[model samples]
Target: MTFSIVGRSDDGKAVGVAVASKFLGVGAAVPAALADVGAVATQSYANLAYRPQALALLGTGVSASAALAGLIAADDGPVSHRQAGIVGMTGPGATFTGADCHDWAGGAAGDGYAAQGNMLAGPSVIAGMEQTWLGSSGALPYRLLAALRAGDQAGGDRRGRQSAALLVVSPGRGYGGTSDVWVDLRVDDHVDPVAELGRLLTMHSLYFESPEPSSLIALTGPVAEEVRALLAAAGFGGEELEEELASWAGVENLEMRVVKGSIDPLVLTHLRAAG
Candidate 1:
């Protein structure tokens, strides 16, 4: 009832999982990752314990294959009904499909990624994911999302789509650089969950990601005056323009794009729209 990709960034700095399924709240169950460690997607009679167990092994410097082996060894239930994909920060990816999993259930692994599914429409689902993961170019989150979308387009879980999720982790990439969860977006219930997940990713980038250096506009001249006017109109007027803008940004959740001497075009656009 699920399809997923677990992968590490080509630079070895990030790891994540993207999953979609007919199951409600698939994000809460199938995907797990740790910065600089590895990612796991446990489904098809998923043993939730496999998530932490796999991460623990990879955190200890074991390869993905070894971690998977350990998981199978430690399982007490019907391992034949389980399916999993694991990718460590530094090693070849690994995957497993139990003999008794639903039809069309299987997985594939390459140097830095694994693609897997169960109760899929056909082999095309996994094939599409593997092809996309290898061919797509971008940050880890984008690449993982592309693979998931490909799988969805090729025919994901035969049952249908209800939920989807994307999770990526990297060192100090979280909000305020205080954690490792760089991106965690979920569509708990949607008719088109994969596309909804993509929309959320775009929103995440706007609110959480920092602006590119080239995209910064100096907060002087006309731009600064415009911002000041917008802030005042929004009832954030204060003696100091920077302080007032900061206050407005806090309220708008655009603090991540706020700079000391310049403003992200997105921040300005958002302020203008809000005003």
Candidate 2:
């Protein structure tokens, strides 16, 4: 009924999980992570408590294997119905599929990733996820999303899909530099939840990603005049156009691309499109 991948970025600076299921609000129950700690995905009769407990154990410097052992030891319910995947920030990863899990259920783990599924089309589902995670390059969130897409294409949940989620954490990566929740998006119920999740991820990247230094354009000459005209047309009248632009960016949720003294080329393009 569920398929998931938990992983740490190759650089070991990010951790995340991607999951899809024929279950309602799987996002609320499946994935958890803390930057610099570890990531966990609990499914197939998932014990929600495993999430926080696993993070706490990893934060205490335990390896992924040891944390999983602790979870098994503390479980009062039947462990044979449960499935989980884990990946620590700086250690090997692990996955477990219980004896009582639905048919076509199993998991695989490698240096920094764990892919698991239950009630899946076949073992190829988890295999496709693992292959994508290993071969794909870029941000952890993107890679995790790609892995889920690959698994779905390879034949995802045997029962079909309803909900999907993506969560990635990195220190100081959250909005306004407040937390580690770099990307947290979900499709609680959708006919094509994985595809919807991908669309959301792309929007999130554009709205939150910082501009590359080379992509910054100085607000001088024609560019500066064009910006002034846009802001003025938008009813902005502040003496400092930079401040006005910042305010506009905030309203449009583009503050992450805002620079104090220069405009991002992407931002300029966006403004032009709207104008």
Question: Candidate 1: which stretches are off by over 4 Å?
Answer: none
User: Could you give candidate 1's per-residue lDDT for residues 56-148 as a string of tens digits?
Assistant: 999899999999999999999999999999999887899999999999899999999999999999999999999998888779999999999
lDDT at position 214, candidate 1:
96
Q: How well does candidate 2 score on lDDT at residue 234?
A: 77
State the C-alpha lDDT per candidate.
0.94, 0.93
lDDT of 1: 0.94
Error of 1 at 151 (Å): 0.4
Candidate 2: misplaced stretches above 4 Å? none
What lDDT is reached at residue 273 by model 2? Answer: 79
TM-score of each: 0.97, 0.96
What does candidate 2's lDDT look like per residue over 1-275, in tens digits?
89999988888999999999999999999999999999999999999999999999999999999999999989998799899999998878999888999989999999999999999999999999989888998889999999999999988999988999999999999887898899999999999999999999989988988989988999888988899899877777578989999988888899999998899988888888768
lDDT of 2: 0.93
